[model samples]
Target: MFGRSKDSTAPADQAPALTEEPLGTVELPGGKGRPTPKRKTAEAANRRPLVPQDRKAAAKEARAAQRAERDRQYAAMQTGDEKYMPAKDKGPVRRYIRQYVDARWSLGELFLPVAIVMLLLNMLLTSVSPELAFLGLVVLYLFIIAMVVDVVIMWRRLRKKLAAKFGDAGQQRGLMMYAVTRVFQIRRARLPKPQVKHGDYPE
Candidate 1:
């Protein structure tokens, strides 16, 4: 048989030689260089809803949160927690005033009860004699005058003490009125329940 040309193989079944690329030189299409997200993570992102679907339920929850907050503040006020006190009652000066006022007996504390008793007695006296009823009115007026004088005196003394302890800022606007109003309220009913016992005035 005649020898085949060198270019032609006896059998053309041999596979082409494989070539290896230099390390780190091969590039992948569409690669972003980030690790692939797990299936659970991808599914969670897709399932999350931006807004609540139940609007009414959301509104109710908001109101419940507000009410809870309000109740918490009320409890704090009753306990005299300075951090949660109302604007009117906050500050060290206010606390000092409260302690000072609570430590002493105030005629104003009895004014309400005395006035009620006088009114009832006067009503009964009016049925018995007009003159007695007139006398009752005069007594009530005198008692009122006395109560006013006592309050004025108390304020003057307290003002001096306040100035000594806290300077001019202690006698701040609305502070006097705040103290006066508290004086009128029965000690047992006062808010921010008295921290000091009678005669235990603040230094």
Candidate 2:
């Protein structure tokens, strides 16, 4: 028992060498030898510049969108939808101006088409007879004065109303011009088309 050994252990250096299996040259589907990039970088690399023809197509689409917007605005003006109205057509002041104009009858309302007719008539008269044309001119000037006076009267009343309502609102910049423009437009043809009828004044 003293001369014999019961068991024996292997030496550390002589133990089996552990070998890791080689990962068999893994390849990316389409990117041989390339590093994998972030999503945004990959997307940017795929984006193409717009050529002339592509630009034209984009412009056409833009124009179509603009036309659709214009049509919507026109429809809103016709129906008086305050939500989608143009700047000039929006606000309580403009609405009041419309009511003021629509509440009364004015010869100024017929000024546009009538002035065109008068101009043509004047031209015709001028070609036929100078004296008749001169007379026509005088009459035309008088009519223009009357229209001007009508607008002035309208403006005076509008100013008073605006002062009473808005109290010197800085937005009154184009209010007179707005009122004058509306006066030139026919009542039935006014945009945001007159919610009030004749004789609905002093409100």
Candidate 3:
């Protein structure tokens, strides 16, 4: 029975050899030789030089042309025998006087509006009470007196300044007095005019 029994698996003594074959050579679109790179020539490396001499000459010519134009203008003026007067150079004193006058004028211009606004405010407050109304009236009167005093003071100061600047000419003084009186329109005695013509009036 033992001899007839199936043979138990016997271990193989030799292992199988692996057969490896090299892969087929890949064919590129072109030949296997590497492509040659393009080389730059000396002529290609050399660039044209941009000289700015022409541009500089053009600028110089422009300046000369402008000078010629100015000279021509002066020559034309001379040929025409035109009399040119330069603007007056104001001295410090004159500048100060002008500035002072302008400031005073500006103050005068603002005075009326400011006074009116104050009066309106006073009136608004007066509407609340009779005492306030009376007080407002008194304040308004005081304000008006102050304004008159200020104007008189300014006029006197201006007159003094003018006198200092220009010595008193009797005629000028008289004219100035007339002008002041006219400007203020204050009640005064009748004055005679240097030039007056009596003409017959048609009835």
Candidate 4:
């Protein structure tokens, strides 16, 4: 028949051929190349105990660490190392002040020992002689006044020198108190121990 070609017409009972293609996976750039970990698995891997299992051992280790730190700081203070110095003792100005104070002799340094001797004498004399005990008290008062006077004189001179050198920074707040406290402390006992000797003032 001239109605249609044999290839163009399908048999009534036969099925049509599939026209769709098979799907393939697409690879993305910077892929992890592995499956993502589950939440529980990730959490477990990251978890750490808040408290240490060995309490005593942990405490001991902490104390040892603290002691080592203290020793390091102490040595730094002794050697006048700025990096390890406490905030109050740090800086060039404080260093200069320390040197200036160290170079001079303050009445306050001897005040402690002298006061102790005076107290002992007053105690002993109180029972033996009232007049002498009174005299000891008077002497102690006079010594204290002398210490005050010496500190005032030192500060007046040091202030002028500091102004001439460091300008405004040399006269920073609390520096006078810092110098005063240093003058009272024994030469060997001062922290950031004296870098200069007698008559070796900072220029």
Candidate 5:
């Protein structure tokens, strides 16, 4: 009768009762306060690759590379580095002579009519005095030569102007001279023919 009967169906040693306490308060790093979410930054918004900080240095390097390449090309063009053959010949002397000849012909064309007129005048003046005729002929020859010189100078000036205006091309100079000569010829031809007025009686 001391504590109970040991002859009962239950075992003598019993397990302790299992107790459920409130989940041990999960304490965060900053006490029980909620964690603040991280804020998004401007750097994160663009999401592009970061450029070099020293842009001037990069530009200078690029320029230096370009200059080096240019120098390399120039060195390649040099005669000592390679057998440099010119693309075309410079035939300036021949061109000058040709242009001078062309100018002479143009001048001759300009003065030929004047010479013819002077010769006709000399023939008329010869009827009065042989000396007067001789003098007139000499004067006419000088005048013709002066005219030729003047025309040549004018042509040279025009050629220079045209060359400056367009370019120093022989073909262009030839074409211009040809066109000018044709125009002069047409004008000369028209000058001799007198215009017939309306209702003019034929003498």
Candidate 6:
């Protein structure tokens, strides 16, 4: 009759309901009306130096960390492990483009050494044989021009293929330059080494 159920409602001597009302907010001592940082924010803030004292040591540690990271990235790149691939080499379209380029040989790869030799030969012959020097220079310049033309044609074709295969989004920023630059890098030495061999179809 006194609000008691058949099972005595709760217990013979029920504990009063413990309403958990927060005891207001505990403000930081010098908060100056600013809200306190959350636990996560405070933990993150506590980590890393607010004011660096040992700058030299900090720099050294940073360099060491960078070197370690570079080594790791290098290892990943060597095996063509896409997960750790550099930003430039991160996408499927880029990978396909690289393979397409790699499967074909580029004349530009030889330009660096050939240009150096031709210039040296001209320098040595300039006084002894002016005509010969001029001839050498002309041939060298012509070959350089040919290589440039070849690279241009290659990039144009590559872009078309890339667009056809991957649509508009395939033409990523700097990707054209990346393909163009890769034309000059020696085949074997290209980073994220070629997954395809010469004479193989990129498909």
Residue 72 displacement (Å), model 5: 58
| Full candidate order by lDDT, most accurate first | 4, 1, 6, 2, 5, 3
Local error of candidate 5 at 16, Å? 95
Error of 1 at 100 (Å): 0.8
Write one digit per residue (lDDT tens) for candidate 4, span 28-111. 567754566789999999999999999999999999999988898889998888887778888888888999999998897788
Query: Model 6: per-residue lDDT, tens digit, 6-102?
Result: 6656675675777774434545576555555689999987798776899899899999999988987898889999888788788888888788888
> Which regions of candidate 5 are displaced past 4 Å?
1-113, 170-203
lDDT of 1: 0.85
**TM-score, candidate number 3:** 0.32
C-alpha lDDT values of all predictions: 0.85, 0.81, 0.47, 0.88, 0.52, 0.84
Winner on lDDT between 1 and 2 is: 1
Clashing pairs in 2: none
Each model's backbone clash number: 0, 0, 0, 0, 0, 0
Candidate 2 displacement at residue 177 in angstroms:
1.3
1 or 3: which has the higher lDDT? 1
- Candidate 2 lDDT over 1-203, as tens digits, reads 45544333556687779987544444656647445678999999998875665777889999999999888888888887888888878888888888889888988987877788878888999889989888878887899999999888878877887998888782468888888888888777788788887899846
Better of 1 and 3 by TM-score: 1
Evaluate candidate 2 by giving its C-alpha RMSD to the native, one decimal: 8.7
Residue-level error in angstroms, candidate 1, position 184: 0.8
**TM-score of each candidate?**
0.69, 0.66, 0.32, 0.73, 0.33, 0.73
- Expressed as tens digits, the lDDT of each residue in 1-203 for candidate 1 is 99889767645667566899754555568765456678999998889677899989999999999898878777877898988767778888889888988998998888898899889989999989989989998999999898888888888988898889889888778888988888888898888788889899888
- For residues 1-203, write the lDDT of model 3, one tens digit per residue: 45643434434544465766433344457757443333555455674556665888978989999888767555543343223211221233333333343334323334455567767877788768768867777876776677667667766776666567655531243433433333332112112111112222111
* Model 1 pairs in collision: none
